[model samples]
Target chain A: MDIDTLDLIDQYLRGNLSDTEKEAFEKRIAIEEDLQEEVLIHQQLLAIHEQEKISLTNTSYQQELVQMNEILNEEDNAKLSQKIRAIGKNQQPHTTVRFKRKKTVNWFYSAAASIVVLISLFFIFNTPKALPDYYQNYVNWEELPSFTVKGDPEELFEKGEVFFKNKEYKNAVATLSIIEPEDKWYPFALLYLGASYDQLNENEAAIATFQKLASLTTSEEYSKGYWYQLLLYLKTNQKEKALEMKTKILENPNHYKYKEATELDF
Target chain B: MENTERYIQALIQGEDQIIQEIYKKIYPKVLAFILYNKGNEDDALDVFHDALMYIIITQKEKRSVILSFEAYLFVICKNIWKKNLKNKVIQTDVLTLEEKETNLSAFILEQQCFEFYIAKFSLLSENCKDILSSYFNGLSYEEITLANAYATVNTVRQRVFKCRSKLIELIKNDKEFQKIIKWGA
Candidate 1:
């Protein structure tokens, strides 16, 4: 095939051709089997290229998760270290003074008994439901109704919604953050932005976003900010703050998540 | 229904919480299966990760319309472990007869196609790879030119066309590609 024909196919696939040219190309594709096959081949190649991009994006995300996991593991190690130090402090004087052979036997039995109690307590308290369980139970963001807007903002909003719906929380946060303040969907975008941050475990950013939304807008227009903030606190085990938000929600039964909030307990 | 879709979407998007949930919910069963089939904990984790990657790539390729994400994942993990253990004398009673003959072949074919494409992509020049990567990522000609200082808008367009043509030619001429297509038929 000529380079011009290849160029036309490229332009057509990219939706870059003018209306008349696109019509002519479509007419030619109908009659020319080879051209049709070439178009199909071009489309297949494009899909392969797209797959490569997605793979690359996924690799980056995997790296980010690895780093995040390392950070979490370090935090866990630090906490474990602190707990060990506390245990050592509790036993330091006792170990120093109880060096007698007769006391050593009693100390061994007491230590064994203490270990048994610690193990029992660990099993008992470790059964507390996890944060993810609470998230899955309470955080249900329904699919928003589809509507049309006229300009570039419409495209931006749609892209954000696509990321949000696909559960691409990081991508959703990035995309939704670009919505202009004057856009009709700005407030809604902020809400979803907070939701995205919450999903990403960026609780501080999520709380800041919700706080901004709550302070900037009236309760009737942005009650979801409070609702989501309440759930965010609950998911992170901040029951006191969550209860405060819950009381606020209950004070006004007209809030959107009032029923769900009422059903929740510390 | 929504949960299954959410799981698939989460894997594709690489969401942290949902991924952790998947590990919590599904990894234990996969680990148990692998242990029962003469594999260790590390091997089980590796197999599970590979299976998850394969499922994500297959989904991206639009190869399978998943019915049940959990069941599909478990099946894939089991098949992978069995394939690893095929050289050993082991009871193969874990898989249902229907699953044995049907999806396994298709899955293998898809894997072959994916590997072939990756190999072919690796053969392209660095410049072509850069331009084509940007193009496939939905960058406009003007944006591509702006991002890559050496290229003009027109040059970017021409380069993209040439690079894609070369890629298609390479893929078409690949011996494994022919075999894969024939087998997929």
Candidate 2:
């Protein structure tokens, strides 16, 4: 399509055209098959502009699930193989084949039991220990350098910090998010904002916030944003993503968490 | 009918108890279907999980469903498995992350336009991408101008028009896009 047609379509899609122009465009669309297709494409693009972000979050969520399934599969298969070997040793070849076929139901029951126990143990043992160290070891709000801002923006940041310190994370998110990205405190606000999202169990939002920090900042906090992201992935049990972040952090030794990332077991 | 909506809500919210119930209810049939279709147990598990996620995303986007949830889910799983089979014939390696996104989204959408649009969008200049994203995200032309440090609303509007034109041109000229339109038709 020509630029004029494209411009016209853009105006129409945005409802920028006058009523007469819209009527004319609609009439043209009715008669021209190619124009109808172009309009359809424009509509799809407009609809999808917001969708891509959600799609990405959903994809991340799916990948985490897929990775969990792989881990479960590995453990389950190992147990099954061990059981099959044990059955083989105890029985004749013909009897072993029969036993294997009959034992499928029992195997599933045992696997389910194992998974439940494993999950219980993970929550009981791992969750409490991992989070404090992940947050406390790296984060010291008092030590953070204050960014230069004044008046309403500074007051907003102070209010946000108060909410954060009081553990009112939802309020903190709502308050902190109002600070403009161009403000001096924006990056630091993002740090708190991301942590608040993490506390709220909004993993995708937290990850995206940290990502915005990594991309938008140029100071030491740029790498610190990524470090926090690595920690968030670990907290969420997304080992694959944690490992991916670890690689990115370790790529530059000067990265704020490079040494800490190197010490990670994964 | 209530069960259908409840199950879909469970999927959307990632409610573990209900999601577990869903798995227990659906896995046997999914496994049987896959095994009958020459897939192994692992493929069944993978396809089942993929289908669930696909449903979650589609429901989030579209919010309207005609079929019952289980039937909708099963159809998606079957289609994904069949598509995977075709891909396996062409390449022995497993689908890469991008290929998986393209295929899964394409299957859910019943068209390949999602990936194509994303690819075209990525090829634009970063300024264009940012301006368009802000615009499409419901920022006013004035808001976009302020955010991007453009001189005026008119400048932002012109930039958006030019960038969108470029994006459309890129989409319209792509050979794969033509194929997608034809295939969808």
Candidate 3:
């Protein structure tokens, strides 16, 4: 801690000490605990100083940034900026805000007649209801883990997955159904099976598969079955059943699709 | 990683195809982060541009291999935006291109100080760091000795005192330390 000790430590660090002096200092350092501590501090501080010196003097990195920016910002590189801007725009939340039109034309008979016609049309058109485009809006199929088939030496599930992804629902169903029901992949097979049926407009088969899957309470995929069943019921114009399913989901706040169910307009 | 190197190489070479792919894939993440942190699309674009340039230039100068390109790029963009948000001049909705450049350079200078500390600290001896960490974790000298398996309690006490004084001395004499003090004030 004293100046002489500090000076000795500094000399040792800089290799300024003669061989005899350095040897003597090491011997003393072994017995003198304070010397070891001082030596370590001096060595560390010097290392820090050397690092800082290098960093402060290295100005090329900063210049490179400016140069690279100029290159990227060149007029011809406008396409790059446009691509980035498009990406930014695409990432914005897609919330379609529908504005209800005010009924300014208030002639009583016409309004009443229009209301009745609208009600009748609503009932007629609401059955299929375009299925709410859940495939586009909710199903991020690529993000889902692929079904790993046990003893699938032929990679049948891989073919099914590719078929499903490519909109070949019939092929997906046929390939997926080849896996036996007792196989570990049966549950996942059922998922794509139901989805493929849904895609193919075979609502009864989709509903049946989803119903069976829903009953498998211990499987992690149980929630998907309940959800798809609710969706299929809606698609099949079974409003009462869909409502019951929604209520069942809402009964437990922990339901996977509880939030989506709560937000369902129908 | 190969993916990291590919991105870095793309930046260095200014390959338009790979760079466009980078923009399409990674820019969304930067945009989301910026939006979550109270920045608009323009602010996010500015930060992303600067961060990309920073990476490109850093690769050309240092050629250091980043462990994760996406994560590293996000951190750089985060730092730049944070500094931008804190700048008094940024209260104005619009900045001229020259003003933007000046502001960015100021951020880079500020960030260099942080980089200096991280680089230096990472180079410290593990034993020295452990002693300092133990003391800060509120371990007594006897506890530290027991934890570190030192020969005696006195050795721990000596190491603790040594580390503390060394830390103080390093901080006091650090070039960035003075800049940080001024900036805080």
- RMSD for all candidates, in order, please: 23.3, 21.7, 18.4
- As a TM-score, model 2 comes out at 0.33
Q: Interface root mean square deviation of every model, in Å?
A: 21.6, 18.4, 13.2
* Pairs of residues at least 3 apart in sequence or in different chains that clash in candidate 3: none
Residues A1-266, candidate 2, lDDT per residue (tens digit)? 67579768878988899999999999999899898777767766776675431122235445544543443245533343233223323221111000011111223233223321111111122334554445434444343333323332325565566667777775566556655677656777888888887877787878998998898756446886788788788777677787888899999998865776776664
lDDT of 1 at A234: 74
Alpha-carbon deviation at B146 in model 3, angstroms: 12
- Candidate 2 chain B weakest lDDT stretch, 10 residues: B104-113
User: On residues A1-266, what C-alpha lDDT tens digit does candidate 3 reach at each position?
Assistant: 65357557767877889999999999998998656655654454454444322222224545644654565556644454455445445434332111122122223234223321111111222333344443334443343345433343235555566678878775566456655666655677788888888887888988998988888778766776777788788777677888888887888777756777786656
Which lDDT tens digits does candidate 1 get at residues A57-138? 2343345335433432355333532332233233211110001111112232333233211111111123467644555566
Error of 2 at B24 (Å): 17
Best model per lDDT: 2
Give the DockQ (2 decimals) of all models.
0.05, 0.08, 0.07
Candidate closer to the true structure by TM-score (higher is better), 2 or 3: 3
Better of 1 and 3 by lDDT: 3
Clashing pairs in 1: none
Better of 2 and 3 by lDDT: 2
